[model samples]
Target: MDKQTILDVLNNLEVVDQQGGDEAWMLVDVTPEMIEELDHVGVEKETVLKYGDDESVCILALAFGEKYANFWHKGQLVNWPQEAVDLIEEMESALRS
Candidate 1:
């Protein structure tokens, strides 16, 4: 998705991280479907949710990480992998609501 599309998907959230980045930030609790979707991208273990625009590290959008690293679900962050990226269209749907 394009930048604006991503913003819209995020409910037009303007949250920033500690570094004041424009991307929305949140700690998410993973669902079973999230794990399954992530698995399709070969993410079997825990990983980091590096922003697609983080230049200090390899930007996800520059690679396939964008598809797998997108996290938008809001939860208690329980029953989920730590320091991992979550990619599931279901997440976006949950967030939109």
Candidate 2:
């Protein structure tokens, strides 16, 4: 997806858990609607639908979320390319601007 769209998604991410820390929070499971929206905004259809008919395609998008991408990959939830990670990092940096 484009920078703004990714940023928008990150900005409005749904909270799932407290992550057992005072300030750590994890994003909620990504719903089909979220997948559809991301797909509409440039995320590949195959990428979003890869989870089959799963009701929630989970993602972690808070700070340090990039490093956790590997976990998603291991779970077969995502296969993020370096380019995608770069885009996400860029979007994350933009938060400081």
Model 1 agreement with the true structure over 12-71: per-residue lDDT tens digits = 222233231465234223445443544444544243234322112222231225443344
Looking at model 1, report the run of 10 residues with the lowest lDDT sum.
53-62
Against the true structure, whose TM-score is highest? 2
lDDT (10s digit) by residue, model 2, range 1-97 = 4544554554455655435334533445667666666667666545544433354433443213433233222222343577886786687799989
List ranges where model 1 is wrong by over 4 Å: 1-24, 48-97
Candidate 1 vs. true structure, TM-score: 0.25
List runs of model 2 lying over 4 Å from the truth. Answer: 18-25, 45-58, 61-97
| Total clashes for model 2 | 0
Clashes of each: 2, 0
